[model samples]
Target: MPTADPASLFWFLFLFATFVWPAWERQRIHLRRLWKIHELQRRRGTRVITLIHRQEALSLLGIPLARYINIEDSEQVLRAVRLTPGDMPIDLVLHTPGGLVLAAEQIAAALRRHPARVTVFVPHYAMSGGTLLALAADEIVMDEHAVLGPVDPQLGQFPAASILRAVSRKPVAEVDDETLILADVAEKAVRQVQDFVRELVADKLPPDRAETIVRDLTEGQWTHDYPITFEKLRSYGLPVRAGLPREVYELMELFPQPAGRRPSVQYVPVHDVEPRRRRHP
Candidate 1:
């Protein structure tokens, strides 16, 4: 038998450490997440599913990318729903900046139709289409600092409401044919979102109150990226509360943001403590 050269062995070891090790680490992380998810399901006596999106390394090249709810996401979530028993409750941990309208609507519709209770937990923010999914839930549990965003439709980069307003200000004869066509589409997009949102909350809220909430959320009253905090969400008469299970927070920790630059926010980790008392003079 021929003996292997030292250079060949060194190169093999280097490649294994560089490629194989990282792959193993990622698989380990994935398994850990599944274990945590199972624990949450066991404790809550419900089927737990997560739709978490964040800046993470993607592909073998390790390119960092941010994700939104998409058709693939909808497919997986719908499949999960179908696999669950009708009587079993669903606990969805949602964290996204929103995504394609059709994908988000598909998820929302499936969740809304579930026979068992549906609860959406937001540890951070779930904006735009994310908010649409929250609206379909029977209960929304948000962190004190977590937020939801307006559901106003955005046509390309411009908001549909803004397009309508701009077109309304101009004389019909002065508006270009392309602009007029866009405005028409914008109007339809806004109306469609408003109607879907109204339908989602109809049974959950009084008719008059639901109508008001729908307008505020869909009429572009706020910017597309407006942060609707926990208090604001409650004020809108949404089924929202401020609190999260410890496991939910633990689950979030498992999905750490990708490493590259230094974190923008930092602070000492401390829990509850009583206020310091003033000493008597």
Candidate 2:
């Protein structure tokens, strides 16, 4: 058997310590930084809960972001809220395209049940399911360009407007039986959304007012994709304010922009075509 060299083993150990120690230390610091941020927000008021759907803008390396809201997400949020004191208020920072209706309701219910106030902040936009969540909050804060979308529910691949329109345009007897059934379901789906919205804001506003706002948002008053900007939302008699908490902007900086969106490297001249390597013969 060959004997191991003490000198070779010593250099190998030195190399490992030199390269690996820095990376390990950096990882610890990164985790600690995130923990400190959570602690800071917890001390200020409620622990801030962030829900960002993978928007094209937030996509990393041109890879789409994961869908924003889902059943599993609500469960995770429930566990997080329960970990904190019941009396503590919550600040939900939302950016979503909306998801399963049941999941949104589950999260909304949890927010309403919290003993303290719930505030939702939208640095960009929150649509559909996201709007459902914001409605559940005691107050909603958004940047001027931030928007919330209409709450009309979509059925499978069908749009609510198209389904209801098709049924209404043709006589009930003339319409296909399946189409009629879809139309009926669409009507019910709309009503459910309106009712849910009103109920979410009921504690904050009078019933009549809440119903009026909910109706406007749910009754096809706007396109499903319409950007209901912050100013317009304030007009709906909702408790909406302009601007987000300071930390939201600071945190936004931590996300990496795709290379195309980032500034050109300083070493590369603006007018120069990027250099490419030649194949060797």
Candidate 3:
């Protein structure tokens, strides 16, 4: 290796420090700004907008923190909803894998208490406890492809986890015993969930229909491609209709519409202020 020229090395180091360091720093700053923007869009709302990212579990374990709400924190969300200005509609966005049943009910009850119309928008999937929240909404808006999972309640075992474990444990021979036991366990769990959901929906849906819905959701060993669409929900005995409410429609017109078929989930942050534009010359 050739000996370095001290002057040249100094100049080169200075150039790198002046140019490369600033560029790298700028890139990092830009990235941080972009991340801040995204987080603001996600959580910067004051209007008690609650997103149930994952409803299946309370703690952040294998699941992402975005999913589910802690029951206690969820109550705070409820209090916010209750205390929100009555003049403005409450926007509740849900995208959950479903969570603790009792927690779900508490959230649902808080939603029910909102004097302003409660609009639920599901941009993606809302299953189990998430579905229960949807039921409490005055209006549920879902995209054509968006889905709401069955309200069938499962007991101690998280439905997805339990099913996966059972499938994995199946024996090559004499699997009947294992299958039966799992089925029985699943049935009881599902029934418990359905009963709880039914109680919540009794005031909104007819008693007999609620019972039937619960049975339909829980009785089947497992609902593959569970009923989620409006047509399916109606077929399953839920009261839902297509088209946005007049107020929701008007709100959509005021904001920058989301790209695509239209987001099934629409939430107006409590802190959102109407943008003002100068009058044209």
lDDT of 3 by residue, 1-281 (tens): 89999999999998887678756855875566445434433453424364644322222132323445458757776777767777656666566777777788888887877777777776566787788788888777775567887765454445533554565586647467766666667766665666666766677677777777766655544563474676777665565655433333232232222222346877887569687898998
Question: What do the candidate models score in CA lDDT, each in turn?
Answer: 0.93, 0.78, 0.63
Candidate ordering by lDDT (highest first): 1, 2, 3
Highest-lDDT candidate:
1
Clashes of 2: 1
What is the Cα-based TM-score of model 1?
A: 0.91
Which candidate has the top score in TM-score?
A: 1
Q: How far is candidate 2 from the true structure (C-alpha RMSD, Å)?
A: 9.6
Please report how far candidate 3 places residue 118 from its true position, in Å.
1.8
Prediction 2 global C-alpha lDDT: 0.78
Model 2 segments beyond 4 Å from truth?
A: 1-36, 39-43, 55-66, 257-281
Worst 10 residues of 2 by lDDT: 54-63
Error of 3 at 99 (Å): 1.5
Pairs of colliding residues, candidate 3: 47-270, 53-67, 54-67, 54-68, 55-98, 55-99, 56-98, 56-99, 153-193
Residues 144-248, candidate 1, lDDT per residue (tens digit)?
Answer: 999999999999999999999999998999999999999999999999999999999998898998999899999889999999889987877789998899999
Alpha-carbon runs more than 4 Å astray in model 3: 1-48, 52-66, 85-88, 155-192, 224-227, 243-281
